[model samples]
Target chain A: MGALNREQKDMEEQSAKHKVVHYPQKKNKVKRNESLKSNAIAWAFLFPFMLLYVWFMLYPIIQGFFTSLTTGSFGMAREFSGLDNYVRLLSDQAFWQSLWNTVYFVLISTPTIVIFGLILALIVNAKLKGTTFLRSAFFMPYMLSISVMASIWVFILQPYTGFLNAILGQLGVSEEIFWLGNEHLAWISILVATLWWTLGFNMVLFLAGLQDISEEMYEAADIDGASAWAKFWHITLPSLKGVVTLVVILQSVASFKLFGQPWLMTGGGPGDATRPLVQYIYELGFIQWDPGYASAVSYVLFGVMAIFAAIQYKLLVKKEG
Target chain B: MSKKLNIKTVVYVFLILVTLVSALPFYMMIINATRDTKDILMGFTFLPGSALLENYRTMMEYVNIWNGFKNSLIVSVLVTVLSGYFSALTAFGFAVYNFKGKQPLFIFMLLMMMVPGQLGLIGFYELNRFIGTLDTFIPLIVPAIASPFVVFFLRQYLASTLHPSLLEAARIDGAGELKIFHTVALPIMMPAVATMSIFTFIGSWNNYIVPLVVLFSPEKFTVPVLMGFLKGSQVAQNLGSMYIGIAISVVPIMVAFLFFSKYIISSISAGSIKG
Candidate 1:
């Protein structure tokens, strides 16, 4: 992207200096010297950021990988046990449970959030009254922090005094259900909370994609006496294909990092039923003080996300090409 | 025409239903904030109650949520400022300068952006421990300077909108490179900077896990961490106070979001497409 920009910039500069073409050799020397000079200057500007980036971003990655191969906690001397952490993780029950939980969340929540977002976007994008209100209403929950969202959900989902139960009681339900105490119910609650909290973001993305689809296409479709379903099926769906792919990939990547909601809502339980891979890494690295094993699990997560990222990058590049 | 009108009516009804579902929790939160624990326990009510001061007093007795607010504000403001200025600087460098290894460096940053943030959590914790920066805001604040996604967005914004001829004109008029960046480019990029800054501030404000892991002190805890603390503490027993505490964290941002909803929504839209 940067190289393309620079090439275009060079072309612009050359065209702008069209009348001064007689000094080509001198210009080339000056340009070479200027390139070297600009390199230093650019580095100067980039230096402050690079310093912090390397320390925090780059170093931690390398350090995390190194720590994974060792056997110790932070602030202590370590012994190198080559690939032992990885080998152990291969058969680790808790690790597998957490991995499955995270993937399950990605599987369930990603599609729901993306599809619902598309529906919301379409609803708001309709030629109707009160869309501004509709848009804000849909997106407002997204503005709150995860903790707040979890608190509200927990308040509603808790057994006896919970809001949902109260509503159910008015409708003559007898038994008081423990929403977060049962394993399956707890996952459902987390999924519901996750969807409500994040669906707005995907909605906005789809709205953008919807707006980009030209009116002329729809008008032409209408001229052909296409029904609303026919127009949506043939034009709207195809036009939104890119954004849907982008949202799906992004949502899945996000869902894979699930922690805060379940961590707060159920503390990853009814017996670790909702413990995401991230919460597992947190438990091992922080609570248990086993930095080596935690770092190993972190790498596994990085590996999983890298697959999604690679696909996203390939699609983005293809679109650009 | 009647059929079309019927479809529109159905669509409107569906939209209203979604709107109510979306806003239901918030309505309950507000109503519950004014109700005492006993009242909340009795059942949910739509009417306002008279325990607002009592709830505030109870919550304040347990936790200084205002302190958490202050800590969160300080950290988020600094993170936003550092991320915006430094990202713009880095983006300007990449956008304008024909530097050696620039392509590789930019690509490296892009790849790093794709790396899940949790990948570095353990090592970052260790690094902070090693450097004795754990329990300090340095771990949270300093990392904002190298925000790759912000830089990527800003560079893309600059690539299309910024003209090299403008920089050349500034140079001919005796402006230094840095001066031109500040005086010329920065102003042009302010809209984008402001757009990105909203996300940065919100991201920092809502960051939970990092602060939970790094900061141990109650007074230094950010809003999200404090919310967790509130859940675990005695405050959770008093449902009204707990609702009020959560509301205190949410309502201000909710109002701000409403005020800037159009801009914020547009920025999200633009961000996804550009991103």
Candidate 2:
């Protein structure tokens, strides 16, 4: 009887050990299941957006590529024209001219926008009294629609009785500049208007970047007897490298996609001088009713943009190896 | 040492001058709006004039300005709300989920964000036409709802700020997933929601191309499209009322920005600078 009782106690002890060993495993299994369930729920939430993106953006992008290859005959039939449209685009004077115009606008407007933006940023970052009001004032233009800015500037830049010419007159300059009538002057006018309209955005971006720099960096430089110029060059410039790269890339992309300003301000110009590639594509597609040709032009623009974006990514976004 | 003070003064002067240059066009727009048509044509007006009431009347009479404002407001509000929710949901998914193809999908979203707006214009127009949504506001609102920038922005916010452990804790408490999202995740995402709302609002309010192509009727035109039509029409040639129209279009956005400049500035800084 004693031996049987001892054996029963040993079995009971072994059973208790087994329960302890299996308890955490069961809990872990339950946890793993719960995680899987949560993941499923997450995917369910994401599903709708995935469908929308695929249908709206991805599908259209793919269709655009295919449409570029076809002679789109009002959606009735697609004649496969292999590389024909691309070949024709090579000799298209309007395309080349518009491309050149876009490049010119980028060259003129980008640096001006960047420099002006940085200046505004520096001022706002100083946290002077009434800086909030000034910041709001500086950013107000960016809020205005491009169309409104174009219209307002149109009035301002009017040649005969325009405000700009009137100001020039007051300064003893009798010459009435055809701001939007002359080819070169029209481009310049558009550039000036664009610079005013867009400077706010870049300013905000630069301000944001500037604020990210630790105040300690400036204090440290001050302790070293650094001049403001020295501090700006040594500290501010280097700290802003990332943001500057971002601004350059963003501004470049924006400049490359120039459409509304030129379209509204110059109507593609005083003889096509201010017409950018997108505007050309727009006129081709809507105004001219040549979707096939327009599609081709758009693809070429995309190719150029892609190349620019690629180079920008390569230079600006290269991760350390 | 005094030379440094002189240089600092010069720099301040230079900054003020540039600020004046920046402020010039806006000043001109206001001045021209207050001037008579004759004064506008005669040249720049530096002083305030008495044409504000008259110009406002003329502008109101000339264009369906109220309708345009209403349309812009409706469209912008809808875009802000819908896009914000959708973006937050998608961001939540990308942040919390360990699903198949998650990394690839997120990368694709990032890639799509880089594509220029004009790239899809023709295709998007044709798609709208095919979907029988041409000449409607759906074309404007729907596509914008799927903004890649918003998705990318929200995703970054979610991944960095939202704690997965909180989600797990909720799950362990037997809270349903949707409930967890609503109860747990959303309140914490206010900053992101605010940021995206501003961006989407600005984009929708300023949209021209899609609306220009889609909405043919003048009554349906948003502010930008109406402004475009106004600029193209004979009424747009009237220097006085045109400036007034420009002012009317610009004022609302300025007002909104004035109220929310802090949020706007902070959000822009956080999104771009941090990224």
Candidate 3:
């Protein structure tokens, strides 16, 4: 989420200001006492959250790394075999397939969603009538849980009795097409459902970015006889660079974590054709009862995501710097 | 002007078509939820049938979806409250106090926020099993107290909006530090907390994977998990009931989103820019 890397800098600046504001108030002894009291109070305030944060988030991250190094299932004693799971992962075919599946999804969905989002944003930012309705209609699906989105798609795309086929029948193309049965069409269906489900968030972000671009720039382009295409290519695209990068990184990270839609819609069916790496991790950990290998695969996912996140951080710094 | 009007008409027509594509599935779901399973299998229709009660009866016969709704609501509300309060307190602590390990600690939190959630799945499962909190809502709900993104947003919010003079005023009035936080800072952070709360609530409601892995009992299933269960159950035999089941899970959120569409849209905008 906070894909930008400058939060620490911003926080330091904030703390520096607070220090300057409060430092003038004291001599050494009273200031020491005051500092002690504030420190105690601050820890007390932070304790409740920090306790949970460490237990839930921070501890699990470390535990996951350790778990990846061991050979065991849950409830079994873990034998510490250093790099054993990672070594096995190198030869794991299912892991490669699922990882490739996930990468293919990220490659397809990220650009599709971002580009369509920009188009939708342009339409919404057109200052046209009925854009309010357009905005809500586009965004409304994003609020639904993934299961619900999958359900609606499954209902519409299911063979023989599917709504899509029924409509297609009337259009003189009558065939019992199993949308989720074949691997390629299943991926396409998943992509369409995903585009419907998530394109709105990116669209809303782009709309915000577009709105932030001053109208005067567009007016200036218009006076210079810039065509609509030229204005969009020059003025609009450049101004949206930051938000575009953010949305792309966020969307790729999200797409890389794809599990729910395929899980619910097709159950990663047709012989795990649509299975993403997260589902692979789930199958390993829960279904096959191998927490060690599962953690190892998860770390691979973590590695891929960390690389993307690093790229995002670099882009953010380059833009701002 | 007439040529421009023609282009406008074409654009409007295109938009209306897109809206149809967007909304048609929902309309079909709502309509087919009222149709007979046989009628639904026969062909899709725009008209509603008199089988709404029958579809609901069939769905209820298989799964008590309302129980899942209740479970989702419980988890979502608890998560929203706990995350909001603790994130506010944590943010306030970072904002007002200059303390030890404060800078590194906050930075650690920001870094952790970037780690994909699935990375910790296996370990989180093991930790719950180790602690014996498996098959319970505790795993789903208790972890909300340390939502890093919420804390980050709230901290930035306080930085720009909350003034130190106000905290000093509260302190000079003999209010204790925690009291100052409660009476002074919490109210100031309320608006930002509320905005983040909507996301927190929705996120917790839609949290399927953790609940799916943790809660094995049908009685304890959240709505999303229940919908997945419903898909696998005999209720899928009845397409009408299946449609009704999905609609039942979806329609309430749709209605609620319509109510807060403007606020939610703006929050997404603000959240993106700030993050």
Candidate 4:
């Protein structure tokens, strides 16, 4: 992308130069030296970030691929067992369940979050008296750390004494719902906490997108006596295309990395039902001390995220185009 | 007109009710933090209970909040500063300097934004172990120096705000490249940096998984790790300490949000939209 962008500029610079009088070779040499000096300075600034990036992130990623091929654990000598870990994962029921669990989360959470975000954005964006209260009330949860949020939700969702069950009882839910004890309820608990903790961010994003839309379009619609739904469909929805794409992509990528809420809330189950792919990798690598197999599992997740990201990029670029 | 007024009233009521769902957990937490384990079990209460000091005492006994607080502060502050500054410098390098391979390098870094950090978790752990920094905070704070998202955001910020003519003027006035970046450019990027810093601080302060994996020592655990410990040990037998622990972890962020949320909210949108 960068190369193509710069290539056009380079051609423009050359064509503009072609129309100029020829400069002396010595002057060109001095310009080259000046460019070198700037390059040195640019590199000087870039060195620290690049060094850490390579060491902590880039190198480890490449090494992770190689590590996946072996049966070695952390810092141990490896016996070269090619594709063994990958083959094991093929038959691993837990791994497959975790994968599906993560996908289920993304699929369910993404649209709901986006739609909820849009609704909240519309409400708060209106000239309402409770705008400040509404905005902060919705977004405050997003600021809490996952452990903190998860802890609060656990308090709210525990089987017998949970705040949520108590509230449900007030609304005539006589049975004490085992929110975090039953498998389905456990997943629901994770989803509810996640939705509360995260919806605020998407709301803010959609709010921004909605706010950017010029009021002139809406005013025109108003003069034409357009209904509210019609105005929303024609002006609001179309104008929000960019932010919607961004929110979808960012939210899905984030949801795919789900670990903390489920991990802390139900401890990854009523039995592996809510265990996300990331937590599974953590258990394999840290608990079981099988770094090789863990890395193999991680690569599969990485590939999935990369594909989503690729589609997101395509959507973003299409919008830009 | 009456029907329209009724519909508007319905929308207002609906919004406030939705706000209740979001805010109720927080209110319940604060209220219950004052209640005993027995009171918490009986039912949710509308009022505070008398166990506030007792819960605090209980939490202090189980988890070392001081150690967790200090460790989290150190990690978050260091990560925020390092990431905010270096990311700006890297973005500046890309925005202003015309160099060989700069475009390709910047593009490579852009692609890096999409790569999940979890992809390299095992490798990072083993790599850190190989280097003998396994349990230290080195693995936790060092990697944040290369935040691709911040670099990407600030690069876009700079491209629009920073003009090449300013650099030419700085050079004409005898400022060196580094000095120009520091004096002329840094101030201009300060707002973006400050915005990114808040986000970085909140993220690192709340980061759980990396610390859980990298640091094994109980004393070195951050708040999230310690909170997990608190829950695992006490939620079944006594949740008073767990409630106190949650309050301790969440209240600071809630307080910070109350104080500076407008800035945080504005910054959140600022990065997404073109200036």
Candidate 5:
């Protein structure tokens, strides 16, 4: 019998056995009836989330893949030119440049966040006076939205009236530096904003990791006459290996979605020097009205991020092995 | 002993200095909001200036930020309440029920969490358009009701905390199924739910790109979107107004952060470990 028919038959048998076999029968029959009720109850509760998830997330993902294979802009009749969008993406310079810019950002910002986060965690995680206030201070910036972060940085990095240059002016520097206008400096501005805005979460992760380390280890190191750096290098580093790896992977994933800050701060300006791939996708789809090509570019980003998660999972498995 | 003291001193001093660096811009934002355009452009001033009311006036004059604030408040609250309640209900289902296909279905949720929010951008935008809900708050608020991360988080919480015996007791007392969830499971799940609510509210409030993509009308815009327009829409040199607008936009979240910061921090840390 087919699976559905078999389940129906089994369920009917259980119900009939419960009815006819009476109170003296095995208790398993009654248990099966209760479990069947729970099954219906579960679906009743889960149905809303499942409905929306299917409608919004799953349907869109499937649609996005289908949309990627088509050749059309918005409002145009979609022509199923199989893999043409992908083939066209292969030679697109804008695609390559945005990809490179995003990768470059991921490369630069991930380390800055990781290294600085570790140091910040170590400092604030110390049993020092007023570190509570210091912890709040370090994390306060992360609470601001992207627009607020971008605006603050812009106000601080503007050529003449910027706070950074004003401070520099008092310190015997006379020239106003256009921090957001230059090609290299714009990336610097983005990295600074990103680092300021996000490093707090990384620090918290490290702090959690640090807190998980046992006090006994510190005493053990002390008895062995280990130095501070020596203890950190030996005990702390090895224990935090998992957290460090998790943080690194998490940071890279966050960095890869580099749309809001760069888009707001630079407008992908000074000749698209700071346009990340996500921004490129937005402009291509929304501005140019090319959803097919945009979905194609998106899949490229999707594939790479999937690989990032896959690599982390592989590392975890290898560690377990 | 002196060497260790020196290292400790260095660490404290360095941390203090860097902490100042972290807070300086937010300080500048708040402080600069009080200064006039010329005073702001003249130089950075640590002291409060006299343009606070004027700047606030100018911000309201052009941006209609109050309207945006109302819209944002509506969207964020609806999204939070809906996502929080629905996510918990779903978690309770998975935690209690042992239906066929449960494992595969849950693995699907885990996979959903792994996929970044932006991956389905094209399809989502198009789907909204296809459904004729383009430019509506429904597009923004409704999808959030099915937040996979929230589901995953709450499920973990429920597994550890929820007891089957409590539900069995509720059933024995003849409480309805939904009533058991509404009263029993929900009350037990309040601490975790409250922590997740703050995050969900903040996420919805601070959301920029989704609203930016979908929203077209000025009145429908969220605060973040308006923050951008307040700067970009400076058909003239009204930079001071923009700063004040941004300062206004930031204060609510900052205050919210200060109020429930410990819970927020614990949630993020727990979220990472769970992920």
Candidate 6:
């Protein structure tokens, strides 16, 4: 099926090229070297930024890799232990727990965001009244800082006195759930907060993807007496395959690096239920002052994300090929 | 026709429901800030209350919210300007130049973007200490100056929007490379710069981990650190004070968004679509 699509695309490109070749006079008149020199001037303009990048960004990252190999405190680093950090990380229970938490977050949050994002996209794409207002309203949460998100949700999830529990009490539910205080529930609360905060971004991406689908496809579906569900299942889903893949991969990578939300919302509290891998590494490195072990945990995370990224790249290239 | 109406109604209902879910927590936060802590604990107050002044006073006294705001503004603004300009330059180089090792350099930048910032926490802290920049805003502002996202976004925008002929014409007018960049390319890239400026501003403003690790002084703490402090402090443990802090932190970003909603949204959408 993929090969067939590629063949069709190639044929379309060939025909388009043929049409372009028939109009060669317009293409030949454009001067090339003068443009190249102008580009060189643009390059010169960008030099300072490049220099700063090397100094601040590139240098720090390279230095960081080297520092990760040292066996000392943050300021007292000098001696190297080779792969000792990576070796130690293999036995750390906290590292494994954090990795588990990160995976769970990605598994739960990515799908929810993608599905909800698609649903929201479809709704807004229908051109309802106050669509623009609704779009802005939905996206408003994403504008808030992660700090604000954590603080607000912390208020809402305050065990006995919180707004959510209070509302639940009013609705005559007997049990007052300690949403952020329980081991199992803490991760859920963080996940809920994350979903609310980030769903808008994914929704916007899906909405853009939806807009890119030609109107002619929908018109064709209408003429064929297609039901709304049928049209969505056949046309909309297929049209959004590329975007869906991209969003999934992006959100998966993002969720794997989950730190701010878990840090702010629960502080990986109630016994590490919400402690993701990056947060675990952070705690080890900064809080516990164990750079060697922390570096190992970070490498583990990097390895996991690298695997996903590699898969994503392979799929993307395969699709293109 | 009935089917169309049904779908529209369903769509509207679903959107309104989700929007309410999205907006309600914020609304509740505002309302809680207006009420006393006792009332907040007793039940969810649907109506606005009279404890707003008291909560505001308490929040100010406890967290020094104004100082936090100032620190956050200073750091975010510096980071945004420096990072945005430098990233734009890097993007321009990659987009327009045929320099040696450009491809590898570009790939490295992309890899930098993908790597979680937390991975470098230990290394960065150690480096900052060696450089004697710990507990200072320099660490916060300096590293941000090489943002990979801004570089990547600016490169894509320049690739799509910039006309090569315009640069050629500027060259033909006897303009030096720097002069052409300053006089011509920079102006053309304003929209892209503005888009990235907002993102950089938000990222820097919301930055918690870097500030948490580096800035130990209370006065130097950004809003996120201050918020965390408030969460842990005795007086700030009260729901009302915490809500107020959250409200204070959210307002500036909200106001910025309201002011530049259209441009910000369009630019973001454009970036995502191109990706």
Best by TM-score: 3
Residues B13-61 of candidate 4: C-alpha lDDT, one tens digit per residue: 8987888898888888888889999898889879999999988888887
Candidate 3's displacement at residue B159, Å, is 0.4
Q: Write the per-residue lDDT of candidate 4 for residues A108-214, one digit (tens) a residue.
A: 88888898889889989999797977788899998888888888887787767888788898889898788888888787778778889888888988888888889
What clash pairs does model 4 have? none
CA lDDT, candidate 1, residue B34: 98
- Stretches of candidate 2 above 4 Å error? A1-39, A72-78, A319-321
Q: Scored by CA lDDT, what does every candidate get?
A: 0.87, 0.78, 0.87, 0.83, 0.82, 0.77
Off by over 4 Å in 4: A1-27, A313-320
lDDT of 1 by residue, A1-321 (tens): 323344446544643453133223435887667557867998998998899999999899899999999998778899999999999998999999999999899888987898789898998998888898778878888878888889999999999999999999989998999999999899899988888888888899899889988999999999999988999999999778778877877787778888999999999998988899999999999889999999999999988888866776687535644
Q: What TM-score does the A-chain of candidate 4 achieve? A: 0.89
Give the C-alpha miss distance for residue A108 in model 3, angstroms: 0.7
Error of 1 at A100 (Å): 0.8
Candidate 2 colliding pairs: none
| Error at A240, model 3, angstroms | 1.9
Native A-B interface contacts kept, per candidate: 0.69, 0.57, 0.72, 0.72, 0.61, 0.53
Query: lDDT: which is higher, 3 or 5?
Result: 3
How well does candidate 3 score on lDDT at residue A185? 96
Interface RMSD of 3: 2.2
TM-score of 3: 0.95
Candidate with more favorable, higher lDDT: 1 or 2: 1
Model 2 deviation from the true structure expressed as Cα RMSD, one decimal place: 10.0
DockQ values, each candidate: 0.60, 0.47, 0.66, 0.59, 0.53, 0.42
lDDT score, residue A149, model 4? 84
TM-score of chain A of 2: 0.85
Pairs that collide in candidate 1 are none
For residues B1-275, could you state the per-residue lDDT of candidate 6 as single tens digits?
99878967776677678878988997898888888888877788679889888888887777788899999999988988888777766666666555445657767777777777776677677778878999999989877787777877777666666666666687689997567667877787888788778778767887877898898988888988888878888876666777777887887777877777767667777656654
